[model samples]
Target chain A: MSAVDTRVPQPTTPTPPSPRRMGPDARRVTARTVRYTLLFLFLVFVLIPVYVLLVTSFKPGTEATLTGAWDLPQNWTLDAWREAWDALSPSLWRSFAIAIPASIVSAILGSMNGFVFSRWRFPGSDIVFTLFLFGMFIPYQAVMIPLRQLTSDLGLASGVPTLIVVHIAYGIPICSLIFRGYYSTTIPNELVEAGRVDGAGLIRTYALIVLPLSAPGFVVTLIWQFTSVWNDFLFAIFLSNTRNGPVTIALNALAGGQLTDYAASMAGALIASFPTLIVYIVLGRWFIGGLMAGSLKT
Target chain B: MRSRIRNWGPGLLMVAPSIVVIAVFVYVLIGATVNESLTDRHTAAPAENYVGLENYANLLDDDRFIHSLKNLAVLTVVFVTGTLVLGVLWAFLLEKGVKGEGFFRSAYLFPMAVSFVASGVVWRWLLNSAEGEGAGGLNALFGMAGLDVLQNPWWSHPDWGMAAMAVPAIWQLSGYVMALFLAGFRGIPNELREAARVDGASEAQLYRHVLFPQLSPVALTALIIIGHMSMKMFDLIMAVSGAQYLTEVPAVYMWQALLTNDYAKAAAIAIVLLVVVAVLVVPYLIHNARTERQR
Candidate 1:
C-alpha cells in the first residue's frame, strides 16, 4: 500500500460531513495502529529464532528435548553454558589469536596501499586498484586447492599462523578498498600537498599526514576484518583441523556431533557469536558505513 | 623527468607487498587451479597427467553436479527475492518515520553480526520437519497457534528443500539489504518528494515514477552482491543441511570432492564456480569503475 496513507492527518478545510464515513482522525488512528501492528509482527518473526536459542540454551539437558524446543525451561541451569564453554573455549582463544593479528596486519597493509592508490598516482594505479578489487569477489574455492598446497609445501600445513596469513592475504582487497575510499574522500589532496611542501617524501607524507588522519579508516577496516575472520568457516574448515581450528569448526562439531546436545549446541551458538555481536552493538554505525562503502563503489 | 621515477618508486614499494600477496594467492593460484582441473590428480596417488577437459565433461554428465546446480538456481532465486522484498518493505516502513527508529533498525540488523554457522544451527532446529506431537521450533509455534496447515518438512522436502534453506538466509541478510535501501531512500532530496506531492502525485505514483528509477543503481549493487554470495554459498548450507543431497550446492560438492581426494574434480568444480561468479560480477565491476572515472 501507499506510504502516504500511513501519514498523520493534516488539518483540512471544513466540508459537509457524511453520516456513513468515519472521521479523518479515526482513519489516521487506524493507519497508525496497522503500521505498528505490522512492525511488531515482523519483529516477532525476526526474534523467534533468537528466543528459541536463548530459551533452549538455558534448559537443562532433560528439558531441552527437540519436541519441547519452544517451551521455556522448567529449570534453568548453567550446565549447557559450562559444557559449551568447555568445548569451545580453546578454539575461541585460537580464534582470538588468529583474528587479532590478522585484523591489525591487514589494516596496516591496507592503509599503506590505500594511501598510495588514493594519493600517489603512479602509472596504471587505477588498473592495479581495479585488479585488486576483483580479488575480493573471487570464490575462495578457486584458490583453496593451490593455497592449501602452497601452504603445506611451505611448512605451514595447519595452525593459527597459517590461517592468519591466509586471512590477511585475502583481507587485502576489501581492507584496501575501504581505506582507499576513506582516504580519497576524508583526507584532502591539499593535506597531502601540504605535507609535500614541507619536503616530506611519499612515505613521509603518508606517515606525517595521511596516517594521522586514518584512525577512523583503521577502525572501520579493523572491525570489518575482525568480524569476518572470526566468523570464517570455509577457510578454517579447509585449512585447519579440530584441535587447532577456530571456534566455528569446534561449534560445528559440537552441534553436528553424532549425539546432539540441544542445550549445549544452543549455548555454543550464542558463545561463538558473542564477540561479533558485541562489536556490532558497540560499533554498528561504522560497520554499516564500511559495508556500504565496500559494496556501493559509485 | 628523473624526479618522476622517484615519485613512482616509493608508491610502488608501498603497494608491492599487497601486489605480491594477491599475485601469489589470487592470480597464480587461479592459474594453478585451472591447470589442476585439466589433470587426473587424485590424492590417493599423484598421477597428475593431463586429461584435457575430461573432468569438466564428467561434471556435465554427473547427476549430483546437475542437481546441485538446480538447487543453487532455486536457492538463489528464492533467497534474492526474499531478502529484496522484506528488505524494501522494512526500509520503507522505517523511512516513514517510525518512533524508536534506532531500536527497530538495530533489532532488524543484529542477525548480520552472527555467523552463518551459529544461525544455521538454530535454524536447523527451527525448521525441524517433525509433525504432530513431535513438532518443535516454528512448527511447534504453528501447531500451538492452530496454524498446522502452514507447517511442512522445511529444508528436508525433497523438491523444495533448497527453497526452504533460503529462509535462514533471508532472516540473516534482509536487514543489510534494508540498510542499503534505506540509505538510497534517504539519499533522495526531500524537495523532490514535496514537489511530487504538490503536483498531485499519489505516494505510489511518486515512488514508481520518481523514487524507484533513482534506486536502480542501489538495486543493482544489492543484486550483484547478493547474487555472487548465493552462488558461492557454502557455510550456511553446510551448517544447516550438513551436506545432504537435498540441498547440496556446487560449493558444498566441491568441498566433498576435495575431502574424497578427488582433486581434479574438485578443481574443476571450483573453476566452474569461479566462472559463474565472474560472469555475473566482472561486468558490474567494470561498469562501476567506468562510471566512477567519468564522475
Candidate 2:
C-alpha cells in the first residue's frame, strides 16, 4: 500500500482530467514556442559571422569583395589556402618550436611545484603559494621592460630560444595553480601517507603514486599551456624579431598589409586557428572542466 | 634535527626551481619596473636618478593616454554587461533543454579556441565600412538588405570605435560566460525545485526565489574574469586596428613608448595597468584562499 501510494504521485500524471486545464495548456504551449523561437534566433545571431568567414574563405578574391558578404561562392578554390600555406609555414614551424619546449618544461616544473605545495605542509607555505598566485594576475605588460633587458643581457635578444624561455618562466604561476587545485581535490593525503609508510622517499612517492594519478591533470595543463603559448602575440612580437616571428604575428602582418587580400587573409586566419580548433573540438569537455576547476570552487 | 632536515629538504628542493624562476620573472621584474618608472631613463640604460610621480603626472596631461583610459572604461562597461546578459540568456535556454545542446554549446565556444589575432583578421574584413558598392562586412549586409541607414563605419568612426571592438570581445567570451552559468544551474539540486513545485510555486516564482539567488557567485566570477581580460586587452586591438590613435589602449601606448625607447613612460603605463588588474583580482584571490581553507 505504501509503495503504490508513493509511485502514484508522479507530476506527469493527468490532473483529474479537468476541463479548466485547457486555458493553462494553451498558455504553456505558447510559452514553450516563444522560448524555442528566441533560442533559435540567438543561435542564428551567434553563428552568422562564423558562417560568413567560412564562406568568404572559399570564395575567390574577386567574388569575396564583389558579391554580398552573405552570398555563397559560385565555385570554390584552393588557391587561397595554398598561398596561405606557403606564406605562413615558416612561422607555423616557429610557433611549434617555441610552444613545445615551453609546454613540456612548464608541465614538469608545475607538477613538482604542485606536489610540494599541496601535499607537503611547512611553515609559510600558504604565504608562498599566495605570492605565486599573485603572478597569475599580473599583466604581462608590467614585466615587458625587465623581461627584454634580461633576455638581451643573456645574449638571447630575439629568437625561438628566448621565446621559449619567456613562456616557460611566465607559465609557472597558472600551471602551479591548476596542478595544485587538481591534486588537493582528487588525491587525498591518505594516499601519500600510504606511500610514505612503505619507506618510500619523497621523489619515489611522487613518481610511483601521484604521477600515475595525474595523467588527466597533465593533459589539462598541457592543453591550456599549449593553446596559450601558441596563441600568444604580445610576447612573440616583443621578444622576437620579424625574421623569426611566430605564426600569430606573421598572420597579423599578412592580414594587416597595405593591400589586404580578403580571401587569402580569411584563409590564413582559418589555417592559423585550425590547430587550437582541433584541440577544442577533440577535448572541449575536459577543457571546459579545466577552466571551471581553475576558477570556481576557489 | 636530522630527520626534519631529510623531510623538509626534499620538498623545498622540488619547489625551488619554480620559485627561483617566478621570483626572477615576476617579483624581480616588478621591482625593476617600479624602479624604471620612477626614473628619467629614455633609453635602454639603468636609471640615473629618481623623479617622483613625474611620469604619472605627465600621463594626466597626455591627451592620448586620457583617450585610451576613456576607451578602456567604455570597453569594460559594454563588454562585461553584454557578455553577462547574452551568456545568462543562453544558459537559461540551454538549461530548459534544447534539441542540439552539444552542437550549439561547441559552436558557441569555438571562437574562444581561436586567437584574438585571427578573430581580428576576420572581423577586420567583416566590419570594413567602405562606402557605396565597396561596402563590406555588416555594412555590406545592410547594403544587401537595402538598409543603407544602418551602414556605419566600424573601428574607423571617431566616436564608438572602441564600442565596435567590444563586439568581437563579447562574441569570443559570451560562450565562456554561458558555460560558467550553465555549470551553476546544474549544480543546484533537483530536490529544491521538486519541493518548490510541491509547494505549488509557479515557474517564475521558483526561479526568482531559488535559482537567481544561488547564481550570485557565478556572476561574481564572471565579472572578475571579464574585468581582468578587458583591462589588459592588447592583441585584439593591435591586430584589428593597428596603432591607430582612435583605438589606442594603454597596452598599445606602452608598446609604442618602448619602440621609441621611452622606458620611463612605458614602465609607468605598465604599472598603471598592473595596479588596475591587481585591484580587481586581489580581493577575489583572498576570498578564494579563505574559502579553500574552510573547505
What lDDT score goes with residue B76 in model 1?
Answer: 98
**Backbone atom clashes (below 3 Å) for every candidate:** 0, 1
TM-scores for every predicted model:
0.95, 0.92
lDDT of 1 by residue, A1-298 (tens): 2234344455544342553475866555655667778888989989998999999999999999888887889998999999999999999999999999999999999999988888887898888988898899999999998898899887875979899999999999999999889988988889887876676898778877788889999999999999999999999999998899999999999999899999999999999999999999999998888887778452
Q: Can you write out model 2's per-residue Cα lDDT over A151-253, one digit (the tens) per residue?
A: 9888885879899999999888778888888899888999888876776889998998899999988898888888889999989888876589899988998
Q: Among all windows of ten consecutive residues in candidate 2 chain B, which has the lowest summed lDDT?
A: B93-102
Using DockQ as the measure, which candidate wins? 1
- List DockQ, one per candidate, in order: 0.64, 0.51
Task: Report residue B287 deviation for candidate 2 (angstroms).
Answer: 1.6
Q: Candidate 1 chain B — worst ten consecutive residues by lDDT sum?
A: B40-49
Tens digit of per-residue lDDT, candidate 1, span B98-128: 7777889999988989999999889999998
TM-scores, chain B, all models: 0.97, 0.94
Show pairs that collide, candidate 2: B126-B137
TM score of chain A per candidate: 0.90, 0.87
